[model samples]
Target: MTEGFLSSEEYDEQAHRLYDVGDYDGALEMLKEGLALYPNAVELCVGLGYARLAREEFAWARRAFERAMVLDPAHEDAMVGMGEALLRLGHRIEALRLFHRVEQMGFDDDIELMLTMGRALYRDGLYTQARDVFGRAVAARPDSAEAVASLGYALHRLGDDVGSGRQVRRALRIDPDLHEARIYLGHLLYDRGDWEGSLREFERVPPVEHWDALAVWRILELKRALWHMESGDARLAPWEDRLRALEELDDPIDRLLAEIESEVAEKDGLALDPSQLELFSGRAEGGREHRVRSPDGHVYRGSWSAIVRQMRDAAGFGHEPLSAFMRRMAERWHEQSGVDVPFRDPEVFLRAAVEYRLMFLEDGPD
Candidate 1:
């Protein structure tokens, strides 16, 4: 049908489809056209609010939401949209009040609204509140894998690893094909020193489905350690390529910030323990048997166990057991990256090692 003939609801539907597929600009244009024809269309205003929110135009989003609310004060979606925009604008208390108002208006059991509000809270680092919101969503729809897994992630961020694991596993049982939750469970298992469990969860996710660099890195480390796969092994080619592709997609600014943070971490670590200066010193130089290069270009060659041994040996701490050295390095990595790296297994140790730029695999004679 011609644009002039299209009803406001039809325009809203088209815009919703575009928004879902990440076509924010198209959604905005369509909503603007619909609003021009149907100036009093509350749904069109709400759609515009969400589309603007998707593009992170928080002020514009709030204006659209406010328009929708003024046109229809009881509109549930407009209230939630306004709350989301407020949260993004750093008006936490105001956002919470708006969300509370929506809940009190009988949207307390709205599964989608609850999930949206929970995600907004989680993104703003309010994990405890996010967990409660997600819990409400789960309660509203007990079998919702998305709600359960979201709750699990919120719990994980709040440091309740055990509860997180339980909730994630429950979500997996509800929907095994939820790859995001599966990947999260894999990391949780790896953190708890369950190599076989972690590998099982990760392997279930096809390599093409693996989008996160951290997950792909863990897969590579697990394969090398568990199966004794060589760096040049054909089986590792897909995952290695995936890792490379993901790294290439990383924001240059983010990469620079991470490098700077790593440098700052090393310096702070050195201040805490003068002996760690050796680990950071000559970062881009050194190597031997089974040579491999860290992300920062530091080289270390040998068995995975020997790699940690070599790091300490170079620092004159060779007398320390390999496990102890690995644990110490893992602790330092956690301090820097806030990721718990399990060191009980050599390959797992290298997973976090490679991630935090402590060490990584390179082609060399085994």
Candidate 2:
């Protein structure tokens, strides 16, 4: 029996050697044969789970990991494998729970586990929690630009724009080649209306041609959007030649548009109801009215911003168009109603009035 066990151990060692050499099929074959002789072999089960996971067979990988866990619940690799499989299956919450268990079981020191947990939380929209997890990971390995960038993303999601910017900058300082941090910092600056700053950030992004087509397209689209937004010129002439040069490449313009639309929808508290949208009016036989629905199920007819802009325009409101609107309003309101508009800054009052008027229009004389 001892000799048989030694033979099984030798077979397992050979299987691991095959796995190390990237001979996944041979490794799996050997592991299966070894496991057939020693069904409860924890190492064999873990190796099989890894092989299955590498092949993208997440369900089978999960089963093997589960069997390994049953044999040895303290197996860190098995636990991590199970978490990975669960993550791939979109069971993020379960994966997180398993990861947390791994952490509690003295796996908290593992940078990889922390990263996995942080990423899972980020994907689950728990940005604050993700940031905390990433912070721990960064503390463990301060030199990891990936961890710093991920933490920055989580902070950005949580609306800590300044904090996020700092984190991103720190990541770039650590590793100037960190393209994700550069891109994200650019996005954050763009969100805050710092067009020149955003352009500068984007300029630092590495030109990794053909490696990440979608990311490249996103960068291009962002530049175009920034140019158009800041200049208010829809002609796209400034970027036309460059864009044409990129047309032959994989253009992720549609994806970028979708992301922008979703972001706008979330910010405006409006439902991205496709049923309310009209496209290509110039080519259509007749002009069609697009209906938009809000998150509250209120049907809004027309483009969201256009409708709001028209309402504000009709109300004789001009925030972005006039530099003195806030100052003028504050003076007017102070003289008329004796109510201090509660804004110390001219821009703040201007934006507030625009928002107030928009709300008044929606609510109607209330």
Candidate 3:
């Protein structure tokens, strides 16, 4: 009876667009306005729950899911959303119980439900399980670029670098604008020691979307590394300061990152040439050895692989997990070479190591 009548489906569709683009507030406003016109719409309740989850309002999210379930007792999305909200609320046991119950009830056919569960697992640091769930989601909906990217990230988390890279590339091939795939691909190249390639991907990433909350922080780190190693002081200072202000990372060698950033700031027009920036470049193959002199006048001499081994042995990561290994290596890089590793842990750093060796240890070139 107003300017225009929007059906419940129309309202829900409009809300979906807002939610998909990281505009939770806009989505909520649209959903509420539509719900006022169609108070009995169960789908609108479900959409409200999802938008709340994206905003990290777990309590409200749980209540919204509960409302959706009340409206349609056997709604699969409602059940999955409830479980997800519980997981976010730190009720892992209750969430798992609900998940198992839903599976037993055979109501898990919705691909979105599976995607939501997979992301919850990923956030909980259960990467192996996340990979499995994402695999299922991809199998159910092969065209979902986000599912493919999530699976790739899970594989990366499990230290299957080749598999991770392949999955991420597959996602990119499907949807070139999928930011998660590009971010993963970027770090994958970085792992193999392709700084230029890594820089390219990281720079191309758009603003962090709601689906991936950590993208901005990851980009900041990557850019900071690139600017510090390739550009001079003026360029690096802003990125370095921005990263420092976040206080999100707990790297033991933060002082070293700060020091490197400062070094770039102190330099004039230019500071390093390619030969001097060997650490960032992956040209250490072909019987080429380089002597890297640290900022403190300490010198390490070796081929890239030799240096990696020396650093690995020094960090004592032979028996430890990849994340621990990378963290140790990052600390060593800060301590010895005075550079940020661009990864908060070894798993991410290992991706960068794929193209080239990342090390500061000095042994004779292999």
Candidate 4:
């Protein structure tokens, strides 16, 4: 060892502090330096992989975890991280192999491992499985607001709204500032027509990103609600500039739209739905068994969950054009009856969407 050099223990303390403060790049740098001295350190390797994962450099993350696995083949953390990397890279079968290998090792009893497993399942869009995993996480860590919130989000995604809503409210009661819970609760209230409660929860969200999703969508939806209730129109004036600020800060909606368009462009002239969606069960052209036939010969190819997600995608990206007709509708609604309109109402919005060509939304089947 170099004279007067800091020990690996000292380096790890510094790296841990950097990681805790949301400096994944700095953490990676620290880990690389630490590993230069302790080449075989499994902790440093796993930490390096996670830091890379935070930055979304999935290949680097996989390599780092792979190195850790080479150092200690049976390290649960290394195996889990490797699975997560492969999952994110769209190697689902390979990822599942690693995940199941860990499961077979009987590591499910570990609360921390369950949490990690739950997150991997959630990322893979296996909502039911994720819900079960997170439920186990909640059982193992009753006091953890995060675990409760995870189960709540998974349940909501799985369409168990009643159970999901109860868990989310419980999570909020336990910790008011939990933004993921706040976001999920806001969506639930919006869906149930509790505009006031929905707005309150959305307003409570700090104007930033958390849990891998930005808060911009909530703000856009809030603006949509205000637009629908013109008696609530006073709120809209301020939101215009607020929306502009967020638009300037990050154009996540446009980016998301571009991703969708790029997905189609990549399918070699076939106008397939975005990869995230699988709305169409079976197609005559594909010759897959007809699980359920589309009403028309042509069909959309995306998941039901993706369609629900497109609601937010529409509310976020389609707000400008939809606003023109939406405002007119709201005004007429108020003139005829004094009651203000609710924007997120599925029926009301669906009617308007039939006419609006908002990203896979239209009056006619595509």
- TM-score sort, best first: 1, 4, 3, 2
For model 3, what is the error of residue 46's alpha carbon versus the real structure, in angstroms, after optimal superposition?
A: 1.3
Instruction: List residue ranges in candidate 3 displaced over 4 A.
Output: 1-7, 33-39, 100-109, 196-366
Over the stretch 183-280, how does candidate 1's per-residue lDDT look in tens digits?
Answer: 88897887688998999999899988876556677788899999999998999999989876654553323344447548777775444356443333
Error of 4 at 219 (Å): 6.3
- Winning model by TM-score: 1
Instruction: Output the worst ten-in-a-row residue range by lDDT, candidate 2.
Output: 279-288
* Deviation of model 4 at 207, angstroms: 5.9
TM-score of each: 0.69, 0.50, 0.53, 0.61
- 1-366 per-residue lDDT for model 3 (tens digits): 224889999989999999989799999989888889888799999999999887767899898888888889888778888888897677887887776676567645567677778777766556787888888778878888888888988898788889988889898888988865786676578558787787677667644231221223344456667555444556555544543332233333333444554686688887676544533333324445554433333343344333333234322222222334455556656787666674443223543443234423234444
| Angstrom error at residue 72, model 4 | 1.7
What does candidate 2's lDDT look like per residue over 141-161, in tens digits? 898888988888888778787
Q: Can you tell me which runs of candidate 4 are displaced by over 4 Å?
A: 1-4, 100-110, 204-244, 250-366
- lDDT, model 2, position 215: 28
- For residue 316, model 1's alpha carbon misses the true position, in angstroms, by 37
Pick by lDDT: which candidate is best? 1
lDDT of each: 0.77, 0.62, 0.64, 0.64
* Deviation of model 4 at 223, angstroms: 8.1
Please report how far candidate 1 places residue 349 from its true position, in Å. Answer: 26
Q: What C-alpha lDDT does candidate 1 achieve relative to the native structure?
A: 0.77
